[model samples]
Target: MANRLTPQQQEFYRENGYLVVEGVLSREEALAYRDEMHALAERLRAQRTVNATWPSIRAKNPNVHIDHCHDVQFHSAMVSRLIVDERFTGLAEGILGPNVQLHHTKMFIKPPAKGAPFPMHQDYPYFPHEKHTMMAAIFYFDDCPIEKGCFRVIPGSHKLGPLEHQSPADHYLPEDKYRLEDALPLPGKAGDVIFFNYLTIHGSGQNESSEARTTLLVQMRDPTDCPTVQTHESRGQGMMLAGIDPNARIRPVWEKE
Candidate 1:
């Protein structure tokens, strides 16, 4: 009944590099978040009206994949407001330890059959950190059935370091020595959360169900870990919190002390 993670959960996370927790949020809360997210996406799409007639919108089509705003800091604030409970931070701190900082936040909405399988990759490979480990929490706002494309993680794969990925276009053939296999789609109900290490190699299967798969992902790291340039934007975008300015002058979020 303690709100903190149990010893067994801690062991699972440390050994397998991931832990699946369920029934954290209520179905009503999850539905509210889903409504808010849909509204946000609609707002973002409407804002493009000025450029609606533009060539890029006409050719490539802007409504393709909704990339949540590229600003990590802003996204964190948004998620904080949505979750709006200290239990989130408490759970994160329990696993990651105190002196932790928000690294990034993202929402992936795999709409029906349109959602494609994400490529298998390790997050740390792209992050500019010398540290080998970081932590992530995934909140499932809706049912995560295998047919709806739930996240899949390779057990005990974090210790193996980053592995090369086969192109999504080509079939992964065993004769070719491709080790990527179907990670068990965690059969889960609404409000389930999956906590994982950054080094954990995880991916999703195609969304074959009629319903959309919506989940929010939050990353946290110890304050001592280094920050990485996760996007192409410059530091002047004013997208980060005041303390999170990427310029040499501002203290990195992880370095807050």
Candidate 2:
């Protein structure tokens, strides 16, 4: 099982801090996942009575957002089984090495019209991690176009280290002398997957299409960091991965003798 990355991809990741591994999934597979997502959304919708417009809705039923993510990791218990499949887990083993933990999973659903752009920041900043102790696998469940809020990343920016991000305007720390004029839009059809280092500075644009731009973001971390448990509802509640609770605390469930 050769997990060896192409020379170009290796260099791109090492130098720029990101690698866009394209076409990892087929259109059929993407559609299957998309359909599964819709079904889950229906289930969540049926489980509640509050309308989508009600502010109390999210406060009362946080699971609704998680269910509709289409990212798979947020709600489906099936993600653990799917990622363990050779197509994904093998790549993880190859890129991240043997010891790894599924740190977190999220879905970015940019619906038709202009959704808020994801603030530009490194993934590590949002959680407690020791430096660059993680890698991210961003999978596309639908064709991603610039108009539909595709991912935009600054190549070679990872080498610069974590930046100081600002509010109001989500710009980087120690603001780069050069603006993001050269940032690249990772374009791909449904099923494509992009592997990038956790330190990579990335964000998406406003959705400007009739359809949604949906993607799943799975982050794998070195077991040492022990990914912090996130209580924030929007941060997503995680499920068990490979018989282990990736976000588990030191103690076991309170039922112990």
Candidate 3:
């Protein structure tokens, strides 16, 4: 596969802890994925899959809502193919070295006018890895402007490593120190994708616009990078996105010795 990211782009990611690439997918492809996401949301709702809106947000504003589903590829074949596509995996390899492993995939739909907001926080508290190689890629299926609560990040915050966070259950930074309004917003067009380190301090505001904000987030890490804790394990966690998993081992649960 061709190099999906240029040298300057890689350097920027290293220095800023986040990088945005435009047109990772074609406009038509993005629209198709967006439609698939909407269909999947309906199916999940029919199945009574729980709402993923943060409890904190609901507490503050009962009217706000955010719909989400984990392991999206399991629900949609198109997503399964997209995850393995060179356009996606090649970019993962460019940042995570040759052996890239998927941690999980989540589909999020922020409804118009009452979309939930995420408080500033680092992803480290959820699932920390020994090598700290875990990162996420957010693919925009529709235009995400600031008013639509596009993602925000604090540049170079990853270099601070894991900082103190609130309760593991709440998982947010101190409001007095890291306010959502202070973070740098990253507005993106359809087909754009943003990659950021897991430790990067980030969040987003509520979607105050009339249009919904749809996105697919994929968390990935080097296969050799071991998790510090066993939390956030998912069915598709160890799937290789690029190259081979050098740390593959037979589990006793699967095959008794």
* Highest lDDT against the true fold, candidate: 3
TM-scores for candidates 1 onward, in order? 0.75, 0.73, 0.96
Candidate numbers sorted by TM-score from highest down? 3, 1, 2
Query: Model 1: which ten-residue window has the lowest total lDDT?
Result: 49-58
TM-score for candidate 2, residues paired by index: 0.73
lDDT of 2: 0.60
Model 2 lDDT per residue over 1-257, tens place: 22446666666677877777665777988867766655665676688622221132333434332223433554675655566556675566556555556656765565577434443566655554554767888888888888876888878777877666553222333325423334678877888888887678776665678877767778775554543533222332332222344435564222123
| Cα error, candidate 1, residue 203 (Å) | 0.2
Q: Against the correct fold, how does model 1 do in TM-score?
A: 0.75
lDDT of 1: 0.61
Which segments of candidate 1 are over 4 A away from where they belong? 48-67, 71-78, 82-84, 164-181, 228-250, 253-257
Better of 1 and 2 by lDDT: 1
Q: Scored by CA lDDT, what does every candidate get?
A: 0.61, 0.60, 0.89
Clashing pairs in 3: none
Clashes of each: 0, 2, 0
Order of candidate numbers by lDDT, starting with the best: 3, 1, 2
